[model samples]
Target: MLRKNILLYFLYIVSSIILLFGLGYTKNWENKDIIVGFIFLGCYIFGTKYRFTSIILLVTFSVLSFYFPTGIIYGKPTEAILISLIQTNKLEVIGYLMAIKYEIFLSVLFIIIQFLIYQITKKEKNKFKYFTIFAFIFLYIVSLFGISVNHHGINRNAFLKNSIDSWKVIRKQKEEQRINLGDSSAIKIDGKIDNNDDTEIRVVIIGESVRRDYMSVYGYPNNTTPFLNSAKGIFIDGLVSAGPNTQLSLTRTLFKAIPTENKIHWGINVVSLANKAGYETYWISNQGANGWGDDVFYNLSKLATQNKFLKAGDFNSGNNDDEEMLPILEKIINSNAKEKVIFMHMIGSHEPVCSRIGNFTPNFKLHNEAGCYAATIEKLDLFIEKITKILKGKKYKLMYFSDHGLSVEKTEVFHNNNIVEEYEVPLFYLDSDIKEQIHIKKKISGLNLLDIFSSFINIKSNVTDSNYNFHQASKITDNSDPIIYWDEYRPFSTIQKKQPPIKDIQSNIIGDTVKLENNYKFSKECVSYVDSVDVAFPLNKEVYKIYGWAAADKDKKPLDEAIGVFIMKNNQIYFIQGDKQARNGVRDHFNISPGERDDYGIVSFVDKKYVDSIKNTYLGYKDQYNQYHICIRNNQF
Candidate 1:
């Protein structure tokens, strides 16, 4: 019996080690994870004599351990998971279960093994003293403190606490907003309107998760925004959004909040201001209305003269494209109301990009995922064109801007927490009457959008700051003023210090020198090369050049071999590629070419005339082999 017990104990330890290592390998092995594993292991071993308690504790720990890795791997935070749990329907839950069927099976198997080991050791005497229990509890408390205070590692306990706190704060804010909704005195409009009979029609378009760097009009290599490029408007180049997420960004942008103000009362929004201005306000949105209960934006939409929500369900429900709101928009436009303001909120380029594109054909040649994203952009461009056509003869001014931007890192695109790219969105103003195409050079914040709107319709509002109004002022009052971005996890009331300018590989150029390095490994089974050089072809004029190469041993390579030149001239990006075969594919989708290349035996060069057009350029390259190499030289070519 003693020998049998010894064998069982050995198996249990071995199994535990195997499980820990397996999980560590699957998830990235972190020191914090190791510490957590040991803590759990000690509890399991000490509690083995108490069979039932041991089984329960081990099972719970195992489940949590599995979920921790899963959540981290998928980039799902505790708050997001909680939201999904509360909001997801039974069918959706079942679908999720089906998707993780293998993981569920593994978890069950692990639990059973632990149970059997505990059952086998049940007859043994309760060797562990009360001190073992005390020690376990003490260590667990210490671990919790370490997790909460350190903040460097992935701590599930800390994450759950933060998530719970965030939810509580949201609930409190929602309650406050609900109370504010009833307070008529909370919203004050100190604006005078010149009641002109010309019927000024103004449309504020709110785009979703659209990065400025991805649009062709903003100088993206692909012609994803042909219609926008041709449209006559004021293109504000450096308008950073207030936040990375939609809810946070829109709340701040649409409301009248000063830089130093902390508490923002709901109901006093753009819609309320427009309503007070005697303009027939319309709120047309393709985003779901029922998902967010008592959300400030949803409640504020109630203030509109006419409000229409095309999508009734949450994100799990069907996605109705932005184009679906067009018919409703036409109805609103045809209404006989004088001096109107329409807020057209679009479901533009949301994640799961393929679903957003629906049946639209892709206009850019890329990998399947990237192609889907590009297709959505093209679809949005077309939607804008259609709207412009409808308002052709009317006296209207349309302002288009995204609520927030997304980030594309290492070819995987998603919403980043506090990256500059996540807040950098496109802002353009197109008017039937104003023909001059102007570009604002200074950095601006979306927080001042309310002022810009007031200036657009010539409404005299106390909130209107002439210095911040793009339509009224050509330049910013203070060019050095910092554009603030909020930390993702913090409360909306807390103010984060202004982030310093993000130094991209291309933007960090010094004089006639171009030097950058990109060590992004695409895959393990490929050979890749990246090289860049700065040249003064005309001796006095400077130009930059870059080259990329990739080759796989097998025919089915993960990435294609490509070479391109990226030019930043006058705050616009110009991309020129080298290979004609590659250009053919690109042109098929974008309808633009990189210009003819001067083909060398093993290397290719872009046309000198095109190169001469760009005064500055930067280059970087990465391939499927997970290899990123970059080099920059000053007047060496």
Candidate 2:
């Protein structure tokens, strides 16, 4: 019996070590992770009483810890996971279970092993049970203090506790605020609301998780927003959100929160203010009715004369797409309300990007998350067309803006507050009468939305500051004020300090031109490549044109072989490659000429008259692996 017990104990220790180390390897094996795994194994083997209850708890903990790293990689932290579990219905839970079927299988295998150990040790008595209990208590205390060996920011115990605490605080605050909205006098607007035109109808379309950089209307390579691009609207460039997340951003955007203010007065939101001003305010949302501080949104919507939450239930109810709100929106537009302010909240481009499209075919063929995201945007463009067509020929003006943007880095699409892309959203004003398009290049914050709305409705508010109103006479651009964002809600500079400053090419142009000598030294790289290169020169200023190109060598096939363009100006050599090779479209600023050997092409600069002259200029050279060519001619090649 003693020998059998010893064998069982050995098997348990071996199994524990294997499980712990396997989990560590999933997160990329660092020395720290291996050490952490060994420590965890020691704790599991020595710190637990050999009873069925203790064994079950230890087994569950081990399985969860093993899967935790994988969960975090997919942006599902403990907090998010708990929130999802709470908000999801049985059907949604089933769907999630289906998605992670393999994980469940692995968990079951671990559970079976744990059950065997528990069964085998049921009759055995643990002599050192007191010491085991004390060790467990010590481990718990250490874990609570966030002392762990793994260094990839995956602190299991502390992470779980923090997530629980954060969610609890958020929920409590939202609930308390919702309860306080019963008093009408709690929210008061000290302003005179005057509407010069009674027939005018204004619409505020609130988009969700949409990045401006992804939209073709905002100069993206893909035509994701064809309708918005052609539509006569005033596109405001560089409009960043106050927060990367919806709850934080929308709270600031809809309320008159000053730049210095931390708290958001829920009762004093745009809907409440519009209600106070005697406008028939309507809130139409396609997002879920509850979860993720959405109860606060519901409470705020109570201020509106008519409100409809199409996608009712918690976060797991799934998004119904932006078009789902269109039918109700049409009904509201055709209603008897004369001077109305309808707020349409859309579930635009929220992640899992593929689910946003529903059954609709994607517009682009990128065939990834980006393609799905682009497809969703295209669907939104179509939805915009539908809304605009319904309100055509009326004295209606529509203002569209996203609550916050999403961060897409490589294959990962997430909400990262640290990155600027997560806050950069598109804001545009589409008026029925305005035919010509207007583009505003100034940087603005979504926090100034209340003031912009006030200006739109022609309301003079004593409580609201209109210093940043683009429509009013007191329009000002204030870059000195910091743009506050993130979960902690910290402030960051409005100007992108990391990016290189764009030097004005016109300002740097010298009056006297330096002519190039005909003594050119061509590198004998390749023997058989020729292409027509186009170069343009300024008619007023004489500038030297340098052209360089290289094609792949058939014989040598060297990897280091490359083609580059070198321009010598003001005793400084500047090299430029194609726009595709440049980072953030900053090719013109490099000191050394950049090159591209793949599509060995031409690079030149010219004025309007000289553009035509350099269109057909041809010059040839050779390099190590590719044939090179230089051209200096014009005429719109």
Candidate 3:
């Protein structure tokens, strides 16, 4: 009887664990399902003859369920089930729903174990079965730890870590303020009140992945940025980056806490600071509104006199064009308002670079990386020009910068190839006739954009102690002394500073940028480089960092693995290796110039085999870093 009951208890544990694993697959977890499963198991285990063993099994299963991933713990099971059921047929829905029922059925099986345990171990207190209960506890802890370790940024543990750190910083700042002032704590970041200028407006356009490297207005080969080049404003060159990802880059850009001296991860956002300054704050975005302080942004927008927080699409599958967002802009500009800071967050050249615009093939003559990017930039440029023209007489000072630079290619993964082109971004400030009246002071970087709000407003206010909220704008373009972060596998700032001139010329020549039906000129250097490493190249560097490409290589041939070279000329990124330069070279793909050979180089052609073979090599550091290094043969080419 005791043996039968123990077996039944063990079976229950196994079934519950299987259910837990299946539930975790949804990526979103529901607490209610676990509870239901637990209740069913408890009911079944009560029938076991070894009553103590049955009770212990029931408790262990219940406790283990609580250790579900954060998302599962926070999410609603019913809602998840309903969502999963959407668009499914009756039979499919029944099958899916049947799985949930089976979880309960397995729990009932525990009752058979309890009956047997009671019959066999009736004379005993069931001391041996307690070990299994302890095992469950240990397994729960180990399993959770393993899950957290495997998943870096998105883990509940990591999010909690950041949140707790932010709260601690906020508390410490509050204490410091009290010590400084007995009566009241003044806003530290915000300066003295200036009543001199009543009518002031600022338009901040935050571009997504708009690097200066490919901008025609900035002297690229193509005429991508014709509008910006002709426009009237001060074009600031040599803008540097604080980090790569959007959350880190945007947090540094918006929060006031100085990111130059130390890294600030958690702080009150600049939007809140702007609100306290009595200026109308508005956030118009072309992306999801809920990521890192989205709640804070929403709250600030609500406090403002006018709030227009438009999400271009839904949380999951809804798709909206960036250009289509112009309708909302037209309304905001035409509306009645005074002293407003309008933040326009554009999806300016974000990838699936091809899907940014509706038409896959807008122009027949246009094809290739530069051309595709040029098309997108041209579209955005036209939009900007139109917006500037509309705000003709409006009192506004416009500051435009990208969240972070994106590697020019879609297939190119960040962090996989640590290159300057992946990190370098564009920064520009355009002041309309109205903004000229208020003289701007202090040298500002996008890194300090969030922290400098009080300074931007030129008013009195409280500054939050949270560094996460403070924009690390001051570090923008501070390449002389570059700041490194987790995502950057190896330091890349040095690459931007060093490298020879011959590499620069070699990088400039365009390779097979676009292989259209029409003929296009292929650079001689690109052809020669691809030919040399087509079959054999000796590996000199086991692991290395890629800088930039001399040119782009779009050739559809597999080339031998070669070390990617990095060089900076006139403060922009360029790549070259030995006598050959990468024409369509992608940093994420071992800086391999685009082309073909038996042995594919760093950047290979995407196909069924390529997609199927894809796998992550290195482990990410803290805070969700995907950047990695590569093994390269360097002695021969």
Candidate 4:
């Protein structure tokens, strides 16, 4: 049989796998399925005259998997692919297709391989006919194993049926929402407003990924916000977003979060009420208008009088600067509209913080990733300064608040860890009317944002309590406001909270200078010195996080961005860019000082085989004052 046509067989399998995972990445294939789906595929294989049907199905699904995996890793198609496809522009679809050109080419190869297999196997007794059955069984088991272990997994032949099922579910949801919206009348506001001043300017800024814990104005040691610190404003001590992510926070904040039938109701929002209240509403954004949770902004922005977006999509690409929206805002300010309620959205520190800083030498600087993060905040500050300067001599009340906060360990940021920090956002109001700054020391849950925002914008509604309270937002205030984390409203009393370190409040020591020292081992009791070191085995990503602090250093004097973390495996040395983290208490042993110790991390992810193979490994970093430190964990050695 000429080596059983091995080349053709290999090509066919490779092409099929490519198409399977490729389509998964694009979200064209369903990622979860039932065993009946496999039986259906087998039926399709047996019933179809084209024996190559299985190969075609596999190839098509692989392509879908690949496409959707890209989305999963990058966080896209959040609502659903069908919804995205219905609303998305054709250019994006073409761009996605272009992105998977390799997969498409491999799919074409499946056709060629199928032709060759049919030509060669047509006249034979088909001795290898069970190959398809064996392959199907192997894939089914593998997919089942994956599902048992991980939350996201797709079985064999889940490609077509499950996708159609997902499509139908999404379709039903859309149709239901449409009907619900059509049947339900929008909540109306019929009353007089206090927005009589013709020249009053109200500016609201929505910050991205800026946690209040990281702000100097909010008692952070780093002084990340210089402008807000100096500005006389109403500093909200306890202000939290409705949800952790951009979509959840904004949707619930902008609209009434009255859920009906597992679907968010879009009835009577701040923007709609503002429009109804005869205020000239403007939504100016320096962030991408649509992507991830951006559709929330896009939908509400449509309700504004005039809207301008920096980009259509391409979120977190970091091409947009908050300062860019200033000019358009100034234009809106110069307009003849008497009472203007302007919503300015800032990309005030989304992930990959370095990109947001670009080439500008940040006035507020720190070491490595911290500086990048701070620089983005500073950029936003500068934007605020410029806008305030432009609005000088005018009656303006500018309010700024972050959508949610990010958790920083060393240098790397966990976008959302369900930590309390994710909901802790700074809500500051700079009113030129008040001569002194006011601090509201009560944490506010944005679940009541609709009424509060209406009050802030002077959207008087008979439906809501028109009597405005300066301290507790509106009448819909909570005595003990709870935040929504992982879709559950949690009280602060329930959460295990870590107070800011004494050093964090007492010290503001951040330096920029490279300091190198040889690697030094610490005793088991790492803090205040010597104890016996313990040894273990199989170094991997999960364990690296536990012992990673050993690789990092904590110094008052910080090093510049070009720091490197080196790891030794046997005699071979590997150098990493060193994404530093200040996270303390690896496994309940020591409390790290923020100003004194630079606790950078030496983290790596290796395969299970390599984990056992790595024998003598050393991890270390240099402090600003030229001090060398190495964490000698007994486990890996």
Candidate 5:
């Protein structure tokens, strides 16, 4: 009896560890699963026979897992996360808390279920009870075996440490660094441009959370790209996103693959290069500071003669519209600056499309995969139309495509994995002055998106320092560079290029004259070193002053714009005038990270009074006892 009890306790402990580690794999129910799994195994071992305990724990775990993942990764703490949580059903800060709360509720439910199980097995005695215990052990062992087999490096022990899990801990660490840096380190202006006579304004509309293939521009049945349909731009017809997420996709889109055994951070991207070429580079964005690598974008913007950073939540009050560009574009066009290159990063076709539509609901309201995605596309079409009209009279070139495509319809748990549609995007380029300048008339994949930059500036560039590169069958069809792709676990690579069998089609679209002979095929390869350290903008003193914190000129005039504050205290308002030095009455915000400042973020003057008032009010809630933040608009905090 003593030996049996010892064995049972050992098994229970092992099972609990397994349960805890397993929860990390899922974005939901991580904590509660650990507790319930512990309780259930313990009760069963001791013959407690209380089903209610396990049931309640299970429910509570599930609920908490959902909401705990809602905090913004960077910038000052705006009610943005909190308010968004309250208003949205998609995902929010409160949603995570609620998930935790409900996990507790589930634990209670599990206890009830256990009682039922006990009542059913009441007639059984020694033999039956031993059989049941063995069965539970068998199930746990099987699960542990499968998980360990698939992810060999992962185990119950490693999951317990906050710093061990690469996805959870490493991702958080990177975010912390980004928050402190305050996102102004991405800029790189090497030299001055003597000649600026291009006269044609080129606008690259960087979209967020937009999936290609779903857009009407990509020949979908729905009219998602209605704005681009009537507008003057070449829809490349054969463009696909490099990755599903912004970081990977942007890296793939901007950098070209190089042949090196070790990974090296090749400093300065195409954006920085553009700034060096003398074109006025302006980054007008509608996303948060840390979305993608806004630090990169923020730094790149400063390199340009003119730059603007606009927070999405402020202007739309949560809506994302193409109309938002009207005023900004007008301002640029009205300026006497001879040549311009505007990079407009839109909150295009992101999830919660309903927030983007404002009070106007979609004609079709089916929440199914096809219906919801189709509605989002249509909403984009409306905004595109509005933006096109603004570009009419200016000698401008417009190119619009998504960073990555999404899989909204997948019913499977890991639907985003191995789906071609997730990476395929409709690529198009519209030119007002040089319609005949387009060289490739065939299906040129978006693998070499950065190559377009070379064409834009009339400069021939190899620009190959990334995993993906531009490849045209007629030009360079070499598949020597390893292709890096991502799954749920980690990034994988492939060496060979296998073009998909192509089909013949015809259309009157601008770039439709070029026929695509083959389709782009997905392959995985192996690369030597996955880790790299490139030159990063750490937002050192020079960058801060350029964006209006320290001093741009000797006179100490703040170069950037307004200052914002987020109060941790309840019912209190925090305010700072200009993005300059700390005044007598105002507080001096310090950097939380080594290379940047996160306590204060960038905000516009429009939000000053409201944010200040709220922070002042925050003082009343001393019990909240959390870190609050301040954001300086249009500049790094």
Candidate 6:
């Protein structure tokens, strides 16, 4: 009876697990997934005394369902998903959650089933009597230390290890900041220095999140780069960036990047090299450090003689415009240093685009994110134009290049580096001596940034002189080397090729921006506010964002496109078509179906643009049938 009962109990436990964990995967099961699933099973079966651990594991596995991939835990240093999660800001986290709400819903249900199985197997505690406490300890030891040794950053135990390793990178980078990077002997680099007898200035403008295909100068339909389009310079075509993200790309671009199996060795950087060559270097930036403070750009920024970080946080919030550093630029340019190398890091365009626009406003009507993207490049053009004014009559050589380009897809525009557009960035150099624009017929890799920059600055070195000669552009312009893909570090050409299409934004915003004074009228019965308007900032007399529930009252069915936000600016009508955004009270107020979307919620950025133009702005909306109706409780603020 004892032998028969034991066999039955063992069968029950096996059957319960097969039923619970098996149902989670409907089809194709990966080996890694099965291994992870079994690991969880082992923990639950062994910990009979602590049966409640199953509840904790259920939550953990559910979260890991979203995170567990081949590369996240044990991938390349900066490109790991875990590293990205650590680097992300609050707004980015919010945006990503909203984008993947459906995936999150499914993951919750999967892990709950595993928790229920623990209750079913609770009566099997008698099975644990044969095994001593040492068995449980041995099982946990193998799971923790043994798995961690095999999979340093991939296993469950190695998650903490990966996070700690990332911070170690941060700590290691912080240590680099302590050294006198500006001192020539500190770096101990072998390079020839030419002390210019006359006054001279060297400017390196590092642009943010800009792709070559999006620029007007590069045949883009939009006039996003009007100033650069006419500017006389050595423009290189098909210039690939070092890496996709700022840290990975710039660490390799600005510094001597050696990608070893263990880690990326950030050797002597260009700023330190410049310092070694006897140039008074200054790093003035509108770009923020990695995760508010980390290895991101802080390591390279510290190498300069004089450095100042402009943006306070991740540079995802507010307007951290390039113009903010212009005052400092003027100070540096007018300084008594005979030879100066100024590195200006501009926040050209980071993700969540609307926040970055200072002088240039986002035209939401013509593609919200794309318009903001174009505006950032336009702002950069104006910045360069202003820079030319600052350096007027001064002996100066200017060079500009972006850290990396953004993804072409609208939904996820950041650098996972899965597309060709992500690597396609701008690289150019111009000096007072150049009379006409000389487009380098051949392509080049941005990994050669150190060499190209050194050559442009007339740095006497065998590396620079051998690879490129700025003066003799025609015969010896064969510096085109192959670039490697991000993370993979394989030949970039081997990856799938995808070129971004020309996204022609608002024609006016692209060309000379002039507001159309449209005579758009609104009838009083269109939109109704509940109480006083829910203007975001009422205290400072700033009324930009107005929130209220709107509906296609005439239409029986609420198509998402039926609702809209109408703005009357300069006595002209501008309407932004509605998309699905949920407000808690919207469905209840409208008495809509649970299956139907919450289309009634309305929001607009009327004050996102020039404040004076929006001074007399009246907020209203037009329904799908072109019937214009004004809000009864209108924006009187």
Q: What CA RMSD would candidate 6 show?
A: 10.3
True-structure RMSD, every candidate:
14.9, 16.2, 17.6, 13.1, 23.1, 10.3
Mind sharing the TM-score for model 6?
A: 0.66
Give the runs in model 6 whose Cα sits over 4 Å from its true position: 1-37, 44-52, 55-127, 130-199, 260-267, 289-296, 312-319, 361-365, 410-412, 462-466, 469-481, 497-499, 507-637
* Per-residue lDDT of model 1, residues 373-429, tens digit only: 566678888988999888878988888888876655212245554366667788888
Candidate 6 clash figure, as a count: 3
Clashes of 1: 9
* Runs of candidate 2 exceeding 4 Å displacement: 1-45, 56-60, 63-125, 128-131, 141-164, 182-187, 192-199, 255-262, 291-293, 312-321, 358-366, 407-419, 433-435, 472-474, 478-484, 492-637
Q: How well does candidate 2 match the true structure in TM-score terms?
A: 0.61
Ranking by TM-score: 6, 1, 2, 4, 5, 3
Number of the candidate with higher TM-score, 2 or 4: 2
* 95-166: candidate 2 lDDT, tens digit per residue: 344334323333444555555666666666777667677666665443333363656443343434555675
Q: Where in model 3 is the C-alpha error above 4 Å?
A: 1-200, 257-267, 291-304, 312-317, 359-364, 410-417, 434-446, 451-479, 487-637
Q: What is the TM-score of each candidate against the true structure?
A: 0.63, 0.61, 0.48, 0.59, 0.50, 0.66
Q: Give the TM-score comparing model 1 with the true structure, all chains together.
A: 0.63
Candidate 4, residue 251: lDDT: 61
lDDT tens per residue, model 3, 189-212: 455444555545677777876666
lDDT of 6: 0.56
- Highest TM-score scorer: 6
Instruction: Kindly list the per-residue Cα lDDT of model 4 for residues 416-495, writing each as its tens digit.
Output: 33367777788887877767767777767766566667667765675455543443443334458464533234554544
Quantify all predictions' global Cα lDDT against the true fold: 0.56, 0.56, 0.42, 0.53, 0.41, 0.56
Q: Give the C-alpha miss distance for residue 57 in model 3, angstroms.
A: 22
